[model samples]
Target chain A: MAEAAESPGDPVTASSRPLFAGLSDISISQDIPVEGEITIPMRSRIREFDSSTLNESVQNTVMRDLKAVGKKFMHVLYPRKSNTLLRDWDLWGPLILCVTLALMLQRGSVDSEKDGGPQFAEVFVIVWFGAVTITLNSKLLGGNISFFQSLCVLGYCILPLTVAMLVCRLVLLAEPGPINFMVRLFVVIVMFAWSIVASTAFLADSQPPNRKALAVYPVFLFYFVISWMILTFTP
Target chain B: MAAVDDLQFEEFGDVAASLAANPDATMVSIEDPGETPKHQPGPPRGSGREEDDELLGNDDSDKTELLAGQKKSSPFWTFEYYQTFFDVDTYQVFDRIKGSLLPIPGKNFVRLYVRSNPDLYGPFWICATLVFAIAISGNLSNFLIHLGQKTYHYVPEFRKVSIAATVIYAYAWLVPLALWGFLMWRNSKVMNIVSYSFLEIVCVYGYSLFIYIPTAILWIIPQKAVRWILVMIALGVSGSVLAMTFWPAVREDNRRVALATIVTIVLLHMLLSVGCLAYFFDAPEMDHLPTTTVAPNQTAKSS
Candidate 1:
C-alpha cells in the first residue's frame, strides 16, 4: 500500500511521528490552476529502512545517519546503571550518629587544657570509609537519597573518623606541639584526596568535588594575600 | 491561519532528511505503525491560489510575530532569571515551581548519581559536604574559644586573636562558593538541569548570604525574643527554598553526608583553634606585645 501524500499547503506536526519509518517523502508544489505549477523542491529523510538501497535515496542520508549514529554513541558513553547502586540511609544514618556520639564521649574525657595529640588518623580513616562506603554506594545501592541523605551517609563515616581522631589524640599526647599540627594537616590532605577519588568514581554522575577544592585553594590564597598586605601596611 | 502557508510543512520530512544528511540536523520525527497514532494529518483536498498566498504570507508574519513576542518576554528582570540560574535539570521544573505546583519526582529519583549523567552528582555532593565542613569548623572554633576561656587561663589578646581568626575563617569559606559560581558560569554546562553548575553556586551562596550571615550576626542581639524572631524568619526563608529544591528528589544518603560533613568540620575547626591557642600561649613574647608572666600551674598548662 502506498503512503498518503500531503496536498500543496497542508501543515503537519513532525513530533507526532515515531522513530522508525521505512521512508518519509515530503514535497510542496503550488498548483497555479492555469500557469505552470511551482515545486518548492524540499528534501525528505529515510528515518529507518528495511532495504539499504532505499536509504540511499534519502535527501540528507548523511544527516539522518549522523543523528542515528549520535544517538547510538550516547548509550555507550557511561557505565551501566545497575552497577552503581543507591544506598539505604536508614542503616547508615544511625551508624554515623553512634560514631559522633562516641567521639564526643572520648573528647569529653580528655582535658582541653593540655597539649593532647590530634586524632587525625582516626578522622582520615572514618572519612575514607564513609566516602567509599555510603557516599559512594548510595547510587549503586538502588535508592533515591537526597543531598541530606548524602550528609547522613558521610555522618556515619564521621563516627569512625572520631575514633581515628582519638588515635591521633593519643599520638599527639606522645609527641605534642607543632608535630601534631603537621600530622593533622597530613590527615586532612589525605582525606581531601579520598574525597576526590570518591567524586570521580561514584560521584562521577554528580559534580566534580575536587574542582571546587582547586577553585577554593586559589580563592583562599587570594584572600590571604590581600589580608597579609593589609596587615603589613597598616600602622 | 490554516488557509495560509499550510503548504510549507508539506515537505518537512524531505527538508529534515536533507538537513539530516548535512550532519547538523537537530530534531526529526518518525511515523511508526507499531506505535499509537498521533496528530495524523487529515487528507489535503480543497484550497485555492489566493488562499494559498494568504496562508504563506500569514506564516511569514507569524514567524516574525513569534520572534517579536519572544523578544518582549526575554528580559532578565523576571523570576525566570532565578529559575534559569537555580534550576538544574528541567526548565519545566522552574515553570512548575514558579506556578506554585508541588514538585514530587514520582519515580525518577530512584536512579543513582552515576546513572543519570555520570560524575555530575559526585561533585555536587563533594561541594555540599565541603560547605557544611566549613560551617562546622566555624562552630568548632566558637566552641573552643568558649572552652578555653571557661576552663583554662584567659588571655585577652589571645581571645581577640581567636575572634579575628574565626572571622577570617568564616569569610574564607565563601571562597569555594565564589569559585563554584564562576565555574558554573564558565561551563554553561548543565549536568541534569537546564541551568549549569554556576546556578548551583549562585543558589548556595545567594541563600547563604541571605540566610546564614544574618542569622549568625543576630546572635549578638541583646534580647532573646528579638533574636529568635530573626532566626525564625531566616530559617523559614532558607528552609523553604531548600525544601522546595530538595524534597522533590530526596536522597536517602544525603542526610548522612550532611551530618558527617558537619561533624568533621566542627571537630577539625576545634582542633585547629585549640592548637593555635596553645601555640600563641607558648611562643616567647616580643617587646612590642604585652607579656603575661606565667605562674607554675599556668606554665604547666601552657607546656
Candidate 2:
C-alpha cells in the first residue's frame, strides 16, 4: 500500500544516509494513476475544491468541475477574444448542450406517432456526429489544432444554437402562426451564422490559409443541420 | 586463393560501411524480407536501388545471432490492443479520403495506401457522418415539401435515423465482412491473388462512403433528376474505388468469379444509393409543386 510511502514524505532524506549509499533509493507512488491530477481545477475554482481529496482521491470535486464547465459556457456565450475557450477545453459543455438541444427538439410525448421531429437519440447523435466530422475534416485537411481542442471549439460553439433551440422551444409554446414562425426563423438563422462565426474564429488561426474554406464548410453544414432541427421543431 | 580472400574482405568492408552510414534501412533489409514494402516511400540509401534487396540481405552473416526483442506484444482485450487499429496520421487520412473521392482507375487503393496503415478512425466517422447526413436530409426534404401548409403538421419520420444507421452501418461493416471472407476464400483457391486484412477492407469501404455525405446533402434538392444525378456521380466515384481496389485482390481467380465479384461490388453500391434515394428523400417534388401543400391536380389524379 502507498500509505507507508506517503508517511516517508521526503525520499531524499531516506536516500542521503551513508548506510544505504550502495542500495537504491526507495520511492513508491502511482499505485493508482488518476486523471484528476491533470485537471488542475482552474484558478477561479472554490477554495476547498480539493474536497475531492477528502473522499475518493481519484476525482476532483463535482462542484469544481461544474464551475469550470460553467465558465466554458460563458466563454462560448461571450465569444471574447480570449484563449480560455481553447485553454481548458472540455466535452462536458458540449455533452450538456447536445442533450438539452435534443430534448428541446423532441416533440411532446403526448403523441409520439403523429408528432414529427427527430428521435431523441437522433438529435444527440447528429450533434456529436457533426462536431466529430467537422473536427475530423479539419484534421484531415492538415489543420494543426489538436483533435480534442477542435472538438471542444466546435461543440462549445453550439451554445448559440443551444440558446436558439431554447428560444425556439419557448416560441413554439405559443400558437403556430406566420408571425410566430417568422420570429423563430430569424432567431434560428442568426444563431446559425453566429455558431459558424464563433467556431471559425476559434478554429481559423490554426488552419492552413489555403484550406480554411474546406475546414469551415463542414462547420457551416454542422450548425445549419442543428439550426434546421431548431427551426423545424414544432410544438 | 589470395584474390578470393581479398574479394571477401572487400565485401565485408562494404557491408560495414553501409551499416555505418544508414543503419536503419540497412538493418531493416538485413533481417526481414517482408519488412521491405515496395511502396515504402523512400529508397534505402547506401545501396543501389536495384541491388539494395539482394546486397543488403547480409546473407554473409552465417553465424547464428540470437534475436532479442519483444514481438509487439499486448493483451488482446485491452484498449491498447484495439488502439493499434486506430493508429494513423492526419496526412495519410487526407490522402485516402481524396483517393476515395476521385478514384483513379487502375490504381489499387489498398496496396498503395491502406495496406501500410489501415485505420479505423476515418471509416468510423465517415459512417457516422453519412448516417446523420441521410437522416437530417430526409427530415429537411420532408419539411421543405410542406413548409407552410395549414393542415400539414411536420412530424419528422424518426425511423429515418434508425433506418439510415442500420443500412449504413450494416453496409460499412457487414458487407466488408462478407467481402473480406470471400476474398480470403479466393486467395486460398487462387494462390497468386493479392489479399487484404479485414481492417483494410473495412477501411476501404468506410472511406469509399465519403462521397455519399455530400451526395446525401445534395438530395435536399427537391428535383428527382438532380438527386439521381448526384447519386449516380457518387456511385460512379465510390464504386470504381471499391472495384479497382478489390479487383487486384481477386483478379487471379477464374474469370467467372473475378467478373462476378466486380459486378456484385458495383451493383451493391448502386443498390444502396438507389435504395436510400427511394426510401428517405422520395417525396413530392416541391420544385414542380406550388408553395402551398395543396396539390389538387395530384389529389384529383389519385381519386
Q: Which residues of candidate 1, in runs, are more than 4 Å off?
A: A1-87, A109-152, A156-160, A206-235, B1-85, B88-303
Q: After TM-score superposition, what is the CA distance of residue B122 in candidate 2 from its true location, in Å?
A: 2.9
Candidate 1 residues B250-285, lDDT tens each?
223346643453344334334433343334322322
lDDT of 2 at A71: 89
Q: Which candidate is the best by TM-score?
A: 2
Please report how far candidate 1 places residue A213 from its true position, in Å: 9.6
Measured against the true structure, the TM-scores of the candidates, in listed sequence, are 0.26, 0.63
Tens-place lDDT per residue, model 2, B147-223, is: 65555555656667778889999999999899989888878778743567788789999999999999998888767
Off by over 4 Å in 2: A1-70, A80-103, A119-157, A170-186, A193-225, B1-91, B112-115, B147-149, B283-303
Each prediction's whole-model lDDT (CA): 0.33, 0.70
| B-chain TM-score, candidate 2 | 0.72
Clashing pairs in 2: A116-B155, A116-B156, A117-B156
